[model samples]
Target: MPKDQVLGPDAIAARLADLPGWREADGWIIRTYRTHSWKGTLMVINAVGHLAEAAWHHPDLTASYAWVEVRLTTHSAKGLTEKDFALAKKIEDVVGWQPGLEGGALEGTPSDPRFAYIKHDR
Candidate 1:
């Protein structure tokens, strides 16, 4: 759906149910993952790069030696929208994490805590 189609809380909640390890704050959807090392972290970033390119929707990301933080926001919409949720879902799908899996989910807090903010015509 188009980003302009603003979604209410209920709709957003429903969509989020399908995606775990993600949460909404302010006007963005955020997720964080842990990698094995710097190399693994880059792998995740590169993987996400392809997904973002394919979707034409990019996320705000930060990386460390073994951690990556991804935050999604619909710049065109000026607030949360289906696009953000869609991108978040794609991230989860593409870079899947299985509990107890070797690469498992990222642990610890995010290094950066900021969302990509796009100015809108008000």
Candidate 2:
């Protein structure tokens, strides 16, 4: 597929396979990140906001006290495109990172439920 081509359902489905927890709906690829508290919810929203700005591809987000719903599409292209998929991947990586699991110097959020932020999918 061309770099900027608007993707059809089949192409979108194929691309979505590489991105778990994301799905197509009404011409947009969407995902909901579940957080444990209002603070976590705000953190997700802000993280996504920074990522979108950096990529220059914005995504619609709906939030509650415990969850954030992210909707991505190429508005200028009038459909799902590479931009959407790219941004989705970035969002997933930043929002779902677990440093402790990566065997790095940085320890992730504590194991105690009280310290847990995002409800990571298992």
Model 2 agreement with the true structure over 1-122: per-residue lDDT tens digits: 76568998888999999999998999999999999999999999999999999999999999999999999999988899999999999999999999999888998999897988899995
Whole-model lDDT per candidate: 0.73, 0.93
Estimate the TM-score of every prediction: 0.74, 0.95
Report the Cα RMSD per candidate.
10.4, 1.0
lDDT of 1 by residue, 1-122 (tens): 66667778888889888877788888778877776567667877998899999999989999888778898888887778888888888888667743333445655233333321111111
Candidate 2 vs. true structure, TM-score = 0.95
Number of the top lDDT candidate: 2
lDDT of 2: 0.93
Q: On a 0 to 100 scale, what is the lDDT of residue 109 in model 1?
A: 31
**lDDT (C-alpha) at residue 111 in model 2:** 81
Best-fitting candidate, scored by TM-score: 2
